[model samples]
Target chain A: MSGVEFVPLSLTPLLIGVFSAVACALPGNFLLLRRQALIGDAISHVVLPGIVVAFLVTGVVTAWPTMIGAALASLVAVVMIEAVRRLGRIEPGAAMGLTFTAMFAGGVLLLEQSDTSGVHLDVEHALYGNLEALIWLDAVGWESLLDPVALAGLPDELLRIALTLVAVGVFLWVCWRPLKLSTFDEAFAQTLGMRTSWIGLALVVVAAIAAVAAFDAVGSIIVIAMFICPPAAARLMTNRLEIQITWSVVFAVLSAVLGYILAGYGPLWLGLDNAVSAAGMIATVSGLILAACALWAPCRMRSGAPAQ
Target chain B: MTVELISDQGIAPDARHPEESPLAIRGMTVSYGQKPVVFSVDMTVQEGSMTAIIGPNGAGKSTLLKAALGIVTPLAGQAKVFGKPLRSQRHRIAYVPQRASVDWDFPTRVIDVVLMGLYRELGLLRRVRKTHLDKATSCLERVGMADFADRQIGQLSGGQQQRVFLARALAQGADLYLLDEPFAGVDAATEKAIIAVLKGLRADGKTVVAVHHDLATVHEYFDRVFLINTRKVAEGSVAEAFTPDALDRAYGGRLATAQMDRAAS
Candidate 1:
């Protein structure tokens, strides 16, 4: 294969994977620090029902309805989790597990009931993302980069991932301090008039947005993995919040690029003609990075580091 | 002017002139879940004095401080700082919640924790300036944690951790300070150093209120004592409120603290 042939073919999937990974990884750091990493998992599971309901009503798969449905469903999941936690007086982990799995099952059943003749919503696509389907065939030359016709013909999934990344970046840029304070010392932050409760809800909403944006291209498995693995790996590498965030983004980008190549090429080297799921490969690579960082990151190697 | 209107309503005394007192609590009732922890308490902390809130276990000493700081919601009453709500006077009041309330193993250096006091000064989207960084260092020096500023919080001893919390509060530079059990589990030397810092705050004309556990040192370290058992049993200078009668009222007639006070005297 020539450079020209491979460049246009691989560019869209790689960009989509990188942006999707970063979007989920950025907010995942705070969740990990807060010991609310499971909430990210629950949000990913719960948002499925919302998207399905939205598709059922709208009769089409569109970004606005999917986002709105996902956001609302995640909100309901959070509220139900809290209610279970408070009323049953159970541990938060148990509450989250119960609420999300039930909601996800309900969503899957509801999806089963909807007419499937014309719709693309299916259990297989939801479980394993269709990474190979997102191909931008419109780029005839460099003119396609700026031309409106070529741009319109490009895959919408990539745009969704890019906009989600931008949203995550803006959230970090603006609410960094309040988020940090509330995560570390919520009571003191409340005394400082930071409204820690509001900050907490904002965090959940942002996490939901990230999870939902990455859901279509990466599936819930990779979306949940992206929301946790890279940030956790970065956490092992540094003590500063700013540095941890930077390393997480870097790790995510690396996982996206390396994981895609390894998935697409590793099979050929092993005498298998077909490539594997790129999303699954990316998640596996992120997990491997986290495991490596856990063992050898400088901060983890220090004396009496308490073994994270 | 002679009448105290906060007797029954427990509303802050003289709400119109709350500024006359450093901190005011009126008709403050608080609950934990469904159970009431504090009920109908009222008191005004004198300006420029170190006041200790002394009570037996489960007497809501910490809860009262948290309620005043709005860290915990009050069921019926309100607390005021300089005649305004906590949010309005947030920058003017520094609060130290119980040390155990936070995750000490949080992944950040100690200097950053102390620098959190200057966060309100930064407002939204403003970075920490050199002047604020200098002030954070000075505040750490005051609490004797300057050498450990770069270390992680979990690396420190309990007393050192308490001192770091004090340093963070000091960096706030507020007129009113509310500390929840600042001396809990601290070494004698750390306790002495904290007293020196609290006394220094008084000398600087800042009001200091702490949830204190040591009855023997209450009179020696504080200018006033707020004795309570879910209610404000008594609140006045050590000469007036640190009586055996008040201690009996606050501690359900268990006089170990009163006996200890006598032995020390």
Candidate 2:
């Protein structure tokens, strides 16, 4: 592919995909270890209602209001799940399943009833985001990389996701010790005077932020996939948290790049006319990675048990 | 403060100072939903002594420890450590939750779990220095798990996992150590090593309180015993509290005949 075609069409969307994937996958390592991987799926699913509610309230499609709405929805989902689990004496998985699916159904209902025909708000757009439409139309070639005007014209989604990724990275770096300790043993962390419950809330909040940001750019499919698949696959490859995290990041980037390429050009290479959804392809790629690791990774099975 | 005020009034001048005691609880009650697991119970542990909290299943032995440590919210009462609230004196306390409480398959090495005990010293952002590593290593050595320091936590046997937990507690170097069922599923050799370490802690003037299950070992292992069944049944030295009546009260009809005979003997 010539630099001209790639820089104008693929560059911005590819960067956005990578940034969103990494941001979501970073917190995912801890969440998977803590057995709360489904929280990511729940958060992403509930984001739909949040965005729709934001559109209804503001009477316009703007980034900040929608992002705030999504974040608030994620918080409400988390609290509801906790409340149901505690009050109903139900397990966490059931609580999460019930809450997220109900919220998602409400989101779809709202989308159908609202007058969003004039805008780019729909269930299909929310699920499989228009990654193809997020193009750098102002770019002429590879030289656009250093051009001031072209950089300024970069898609807003890329900048938003980049900032989100940086924020997630800083949170992880600052709270690495407490997060690790608490995720491993909540009671022990509490006994150490760590305010472990608050730490857990903060982690969930951070994850919600990542989910909302990534959901805006790459759609919920990539957000949910990146949140669990890479970290889970990473788990099977190593028995150390530090190494597992590194491997997850690597997997996230690999999925974004490879999945984007396959979605965009793989069909064309096979004499097909159009491309597939980047979000779907990325999720599929991540699942494949997880499956491959499950089958062959050294730490796939418990250390001492006989292999099935 | 009320105790001090009363003592100042020249009533019970020989009253014990709550601060002097390693742990002092007054009327602590914890409930799960409608059922109160631990009723209004008072307990005080002497400094430099090994105390066992023995009770039947669901008698709230673990709940009492958890409530006092502020891990589980109590519906009523206060817990004082060295005469102050638990939060303020948290640094002086070390807790080893049950081995089953955590996911053993977590991806971490034994040394890292021990290093968690130094969390307060390391705080949130400070680099773990050589001194921290040395402290963690020495604690692991104390539990005879120094060689397993580099091993994955999940790879160890149940007894070895218990020892790693003990080592983590030892890393804290706290004045009071609280352990919940430290020997519930350990090999006899591991049990001996753990008891020796606990004895060594008591000898060093540190207080040790454990939720003990084995009625027979109470006499040999602990100098003090606090028996409970939803409420405090008995509390004193083993000679005073480890009686057939107290055992029967705590365990109810659930106490085995062989266990009762061992307690009586």
For lDDT, the strongest prediction is: 2
For candidate 2, report its TM-score.
0.95
Candidate 2 overall lDDT versus native: 0.91
Lowest summed lDDT window (length 10), candidate 2 chain B? B11-20
Candidate 2, B188-255: lDDT as tens digits: 99999999999999888789999998876788899899999999999988999899998888888888
Q: Give native contacts recovered, as a fraction, per prediction.
A: 0.55, 0.70
Clashing pairs in 1: B10-B26, B10-B27
| Clash counts for the predictions, in order | 2, 0
Off by more than 4 A, model 2: A304-308, B1-15, B257-265
lDDT per residue as tens, model 1, B152-171:
77787778888889989998
The whole-model lDDT of each prediction reads 0.85, 0.91
Instruction: Show pairs that collide, candidate 2.
Output: none
Off by over 4 Å in 1: A140-148, A301-308, B1-19, B253-265
TM-scores for every predicted model: 0.92, 0.95
- Expressed as tens digits, the lDDT of each residue in A33-142 for candidate 2 is 87889999999999999999999999988889999999999999999999999999999889999999999999999998999889989888888887878899999999
Once model 1 is optimally superposed onto the true structure by TM-score, how far is the C-alpha of residue A42 displaced, in angstroms? 1.0
Q: Can you tell me the CAPRI class of model 1?
A: acceptable
In order, what are the TM-scores of chain A for the candidates?
Answer: 0.93, 0.96
